[model samples]
Target: MLLEKINGPDDIKKLEISQLQTLADETRSALINKLSKAGGHQGPNLGVVELTVAIHYVFDSPKDKIVFDVSHQCYPHKILTGRKKAYLDEAHFHDVTGFTNPNESEHDMFIVGHTSTTVSLALGLAKGRDLNGRSENVIALIGDGSLSGGEALEALDYAGEYDRNLIIIVNDNDQSIAENHGGLYKTLKKLRETNGNAEDNLFRAMGLDYRYLEAGHDTAKLVELFESVKNIDHPIVLHIHTTKGKGLPYAEKDRERWHAGGPFNIEDGSPLYPYQGEENVIFSCLKELLDTNKNAIVLNAATPMGLGFVQGVREEYVKRGQFIDVGIAEENAVAMTSGIAKNGGTAVFGTFAPFFQRTYDQMSHDVCLNDSPATFLIMSPGVFGSDSNTHLALCDIQMFAHIPNLIYLAPSSNEEFVQMFRYATTQKQHPVAIRVVNTLRTTGVDDNTDYSVLKSKIEQSGSKIALIAVSGLLTMALEVAEKVKEQTGNDITVINPRFVSGVDEELLVSLKKDHRFVITIEDGELMGGYGQNIAAFYGDSDMRVRCYGISKAFHTEFKAEELLDQHGISVEKLTKEIIAALRSE
Candidate 1:
């Protein structure tokens, strides 16, 4: 096969123009074979196969750097860059991560998982090359979807005046993870319709030289375009239109569903493990709000599906102006939520916890400082969130807990989430953030506690020991209590601290009356986490305090339970430790 003969870009450069199509086809097949079984970025990688082949054929990588935005679309680039065995061989499939890693290959510029960062990263590479008087060309390959992000626009503005060998390729697939949003997409649509001859061009307006190609899948045309921009004196934008899922019929038809997923059937594209169709409590809550309150708005930053608002399910609310997707712009979404709240509208903005890193300034100044009373739901935080270091939000508590006027709530169960979400949306006091777990447990009993009164609920009151469990760790706390009872004939206290940002001072003070040792268990980082607040509260007292949480680091690819156990948070470990501490006393 063509791929078997080729190991790197040098092999591709040796191939004739007529043989390039065969290589591209082989690359696409390899991508399909691995993705169908192992499950990964299907649509994005498939669409970029031809473009990646052409790129390697035209330029000298490692020397001439190419930065892939998000790097989810780098599978084809990986295949052509001496890493094809990771895609072709089943044993080596797990050898490479889904994203670009500098440790794995010199060809990969950065280990990137987030979007809208390629332009800025590539600009830095260009500047460094210029400082050293190197003449190697630098390229930033970004998708049209990522263009709506604030960072991409900022970088593009900078690249406009950069007088060096910088090539910015806008892979216009007319999609982000979902359909593109913001006013910029309108200009992109016009440019695509006119075949890049549109008068009102966003790129050219930014002061960068522009070139357009409609056939992004044509390797011959892509190679010609790359050659034209190679070692150019001034920065330029090459806008090329390409299908998102070019080869697979089902994936091409439903671009969003096929973006990424679990293992799927190769022929029919049916999921190997089909979703059991569990009820989404968060979506139900949003729907109830939208139906009841006319002024209520639900907002997300490019990941509407994360909030249970999939394509068709969200369109109705969108037409009503109650659902808005800011399009990879989390900062804009947070600030907009604040503005909405200040204007007497009920605003709720939510996305995955990792993306909230971009909205720190807006959350602190625009929302919390102003006390807008907006509701922000941080989904899948700590160890329960994305396992990748690039996307892990291990320090979410560190980011949001200390912000003034922001009440960060941690709900332990589905009923608790319902009550807390309802209370947060209805309250007109301070801005509220709820740390939402991926899988929620049910207590069967409806939660009737008024969250307006911030206090921890004592689940099982006992003497000698108190386990103050935060959010998702509440179940483990109960298990520890049960285990201690079975072994030592003692019922240890289990307290569910619903609030993470602020400690329940009254309940904590009361714990000193009967409890000798106070143990705080949280799923986030140990430093500045919920546990530290508890530890600080008992700093001067004789009440011994032990804080349990993830250690501070960029932890990746770990099982949640094993990670907790490693941090001395397991039920058996905690039970034994508690028994020992009691005996010593």
Candidate 2:
């Protein structure tokens, strides 16, 4: 009832501390109920409800720019900022996104989905405001897990030197998709225990003012803390202690499991959906390699769960000193993996596709330049790209495909992924990056393929037009090809170019004789992607090429299918385009 009456931050500002707690309670319920049915980030949003409410009550958002790191916690902020109906009602669930978006509202400063970017973006806003002779407060709400990231650390070091009005809120819930790793967490634990009196403070070491709050959920204390920094002329770090899954008993007991998941039962917090079976292609392959090879090691950057190496799987490798969780320090992880590989150890770094963006230079210079035989398992690349802009890995192909000596393989099936993972771990030729799109339906394991060859496989041989689809986009292309054949009775050649980085020169040279028009489909960006390289390869040749992928722009808050369709990558769209090209010829 109280939630219905509240419309905006002004309404929240009008409320007393007692009423604010009631508001936080209702907001958490709304979040949990919506996430139960619609399936969005549950634990993070639930934990940040009170903190978000307190910030809105204390700070003048839009005027006082508040940037949420990774922005998963922005759901509660969104609800308070005239967007409650979106999450409270099922019909309006699709209205707002899971992350912060400037396009969605004036309150949201950036369309961020990646971790550890808030500090830098917020600092820039603060600098710009000062330059323009404006005096609006700038706040960055960053998580503890994000602190280990190179960019965040870089920005923190910069912020410490800059004499300006900036407030950095460290939401120390002590988990990051998985349990937090790295030495910084130890510092945070000490700071929390000592109630801000801890010596050797990391924030102070970075040259910033520091304050600690043991009770993050207490709205009165949070408001007081914000008031203290409201008129401050220097950057400061407000470390707030909070629980990852604050309200729910089940979630609080196991923070990692409740981080983010599908629809679940409200009573006992059990998943409503059943398990779709183990992602054994990655897990089994990695397990076998680590088991046999004593010198081989696996690495993850704060996301061991995403790589399907959670719990028992991670512990087994970690005990052997082979599983390294570098927390959010992706740059460090990449370089360390390279060092291990160079020193005659088999090093494989597995991380989500988007996070790998932070390590591009290291993967290219530190690893690829030296030609280290490190294996990179890039999980969930392309259109299977999840949630918000911060999480979408749509530009991975553009980033990795151009790097020389980096063999990027896009596995078509589970069997293909298994074979490729095996090859990547075994081979000493160059760094191999497996572009794992999704957990494909197991087609009974086959270990016959030699991934070392690194060639394109022709799924269906035909004439005139060649459909070169990369990785996960293959299924969509195949569906389009089927429709084209039914309508026009023309058999179009479908080739799965597994290796996106290297030009399958032998395959391309052979295609010149048979195909006249070539169409390349990729799940990443069109500009500087695998498709463009193919287009460039045939620039002076007889074959005319049309590349289909995401355009060079920041696409935000879109369903996977909608994004694909918008980019002319859907089955109907691709089929029409191919037919038109055929007709034009």
Q: What are the per-model C-alpha RMSD values against the true structure? A: 0.9, 2.4
Segments in model 2 whose C-alpha atoms lie over 4 Å from true places: 439-442, 445-447, 476-491, 565-585
TM-score: model 2 vs. ground truth: 0.93
On lDDT, the leading prediction is 1
How big is the positional error of residue 464 in model 1, measured in Å on the Cα after superposition?
0.4
lDDT of each: 0.92, 0.86
Which segments of model 1 are wrong by more than 4 Å? none
Model 2 Cα lDDT, one tens digit per residue, 1-585: 789978888888888877888999998888987888888877788888889988988889879999999888889999999899988899999898888877778889888888889999999999899889999999999994899888898999999899989999999998888888978889988898899888969999989999999999988888888888896899999999888878889988888888788888989998899797765567778888888999999998888887778876688678889899988889999999999999999999988887888888998999999999999988888777664566678888888878889998888878888888888988998999999887354558684778878789898887889999888777777788899999888889999887888778888888888789999988888888888888999999988898888877666667778887888888998899888877886
Candidate 2 residue 193 C-alpha distance from true site, Å: 1.7
Q: Count the backbone clashes (under 3 Å) in each candidate.
A: 0, 2
